[model samples]
Target: MIGICKSFGANKVLGGVNLHVRPGEVHALMGENGAGKSTLMNILTGIHRADAGTIMVDGKEVTFKNNKDAEEHGIAFIHQELNIWPNLSVLENLFLMNQPKTRFGTIDFKKMREMAEAKCQEIGIDLPLDEIAGECSVGQQQMTEITRSLMLDAKTVIMDEPTAALTERETDRLFEVMKKLKNKGVSIIYISHRMEEVFANCDTITVMRDGQTISSRPTEETNMDQIVGDMVGRIMSEYYPARTNVPGDEIFRVEGFTQPGVFRDISFNLRKGEILGVAGLMGAGRTEIMRAIFGVDPHESGKLYFEGKEIHIKNPRDAIRHGFGFITENRKTEGLILDFSIERNIALPSEERLAQSHVINDKKEFDFSSELSKRLGVKAQDINLPASTLSGGNQQKVVIAKWVGMHPKLLILDEPTRGIDIGAKKDIYDLMNELTAKGVSIIMVSSELPEVIGMSDRILVIHEGRAAGIVEHKDATQTRIMTLATGGE
Candidate 1:
């Protein structure tokens, strides 16, 4: 694509952007959340039309009418969000709207099974073909999407944050498959926020900022600092900010937190002003434990205490009433209402406080939301814009602002910075320090080991739904945490 330009009303998403991918090469696309990467890809796949641009596929200029048209032209896009049908089986999902038939006009289940098994074996992934897609883990669902894309035999495949939901072992398997595909003369457009993965796996790198291409260089020619500098337009002196908040006496404790078949014997504690990092492999019940503690899900047996006194939480309202806030992992669905304005979403939890005699005070709500949004450094034209209009980083800031407005003693942040850029990540870390300084304890559940080690005063490693070990900041290392997370001693 050359000179691609797109506009969404007054917002110019892509401004004369350019991208060139060689055949059989892994090209990495690096950018902040609103850097026009997604918009460019959407235009390539015909999800949106470019105001001005030209695309050349195999030296022939052509335009795609839709994603299906792009697929027909040997270009496939695997979105970050898995497009799996929850009610259908894995096999059914793999062949939805595209299935082979026998001479008698009947679906060929045998052929589908054989093809799926072959693809799974080739990718070194084991998926239950007959199981419901909804019943599978996020990693499994991601693999299902990858397998479906590979089945298309496309020449160019666009992958957006493919490993976000995968385990270390699964990620290794995916890289192996990517290598094999490259050897087969297939081109790949890799989009991710992981600097290490991009540097290690990709052959070339392209950075975009504010709807324009900043630079495109060979992976060997460019360094991380330069790429980060180009993306955020500044040099990051430090990736994780310093923490000065000293943890006080234990203010929250959980004893023998169990959820029967899900998790068992989960136990931990949090100090008055501390960030406790929870680390584990995907599907290791880290999220489940937090969900149960926050009353979003039930626990069969557990004991909760706050300020040295026993307490009971049967639901989220009770948890909130007792000064607990939970920022869920899936922010789009559980954290904020996309259609609601930023002010409304931020003021959601504080409705009772912002109301008088069962009626809301619009001015108070607006002022409260405006203050928190500015405090969190949420970048928006106006507070009345819908939450969906903000970038991922800004959306996350809104979620934090919403919970922070409630003045919770203990805040649970699950995957707090999952899909944001490095610049935004530093902003969040700084905000966390500010909150901790103000005496708010935090329990952060994360998959990124560096984040766990960087921000946590103490790290809890969960293995197979059990508490493997808890290591202090001075004693924590990626290897040690990974060992404990994978059922090591």
Candidate 2:
């Protein structure tokens, strides 16, 4: 793509940007959220038309009017949000518009299943073709999306945050897949915020900032410091903020928590002003345990204590009433109402506080949301814009703001910084420090070992629905955590 220019009303999203990817090379696209990375990709994939630009394929200039047109040119996009039909079976989703037909003009179920199975084998994975797409894990769904692109015979594939929801082992598998694609001479446009992944897997790096290309260099020539500085236009001295709040006496504790076939005998204590980090592999029950504590899921048996007094929490409302807040892992599905305005989402959790005599005060709601937006640095035209309009980082800030408005004593953050840019991650870490300073306890569940070590006062390792052990920040090493997470003592 050459001289790509795009605008959305008054917002000039891309200002004369350019990108070049070679065949069989994994090119990494680096940028903060809203830096026009998605806009550029959208223009390239024909999701949106560029105001002024030229796309050259095989040294021939071509214009694409729609996604299908781009696909015809062997270009495919696997979006960050996997665009699989939840109600449809895996085979059905894979061959939705391009199913094989028999001599009688009927869809060929046997052919479709055979093709799906062959594709999975080519990618070195096993997937049930008849299973519902929604029933599959995030990693499996990702593989299905990739298989679809390959089935289209795509020469140029674009993956946006492909491994954001994947576990460490799953990420390794994805890297292997990418390598196989490269060996087959297929070009890949890799977009991600994880610097480690970029350096480890990509052959070239392209940095974008403020809607324009800053620099593009070979992976061998550029380092993480240079790439990060170029992307964010600043030198990040420290990735995590200093922990200032000293933990106080135990304020929350769960004893013998058992959720059949989920987690069992989970026991832990959270102190005031403490940040307790939860570490585990995917499917190890880290999220399930937190869900039980927050009353989103019921445990078969458990004893909960708050400030040394036993308490009962039968549902989310009960937990919320007792000053508990939860930031779910999948923000798009569970955290925010995509169709609602920013102000409305911010006021959702605190509706009772913003109500008077069983009626909501619109003005008060607006005022509170406005204040929270400013406090959280949510970038938007106004508070009345739909929550879906904001970028990933801003959307995440809205979720945090919603819970912060409720002034909860204990906050549960599940994958808090997942898919966010590095700059936004720093802002969240700072916010966590500030919140803890005010005596708000935090329980953070993260798959990133570096983050868990950098931010947590204590790290609790969970292995296959059981607590392996808890390690102090000073003693928490990646190897130690991995050992415990893999069921070692």
RMSD of each: 1.8, 1.1
Write the residue-wise lDDT of candidate 1 on 311-382 in tens digits: 999999999999999999878779999999999999999999999998999999999999999988887889
lDDT of candidate 2 over 1-489, digit per residue (tens):
999999889988899998999999999999999899998988888889999989999899988898889998999998887789999988898997899999999999999988888878877777778889999987778777877877887889999999987777768878898999899889999999998999999999999998999999999998988888998899987889888789999999999999989999999999999999999999999999999888988899989999788999999999999999999988888899999999999999999999999899999999999999999888898899999988877888999999999999999999999889999899899999999999999999998999999999999999999999999998999999999999887
Report clash pairs, candidate 1: none
Over 4 Å off, model 2: none
RMSD of 1: 1.8
Error of 2 at 279 (Å): 0.2
TM-score against native, each model: 0.96, 0.98
lDDT of 1: 0.92
Error of 1 at 162 (Å): 0.7
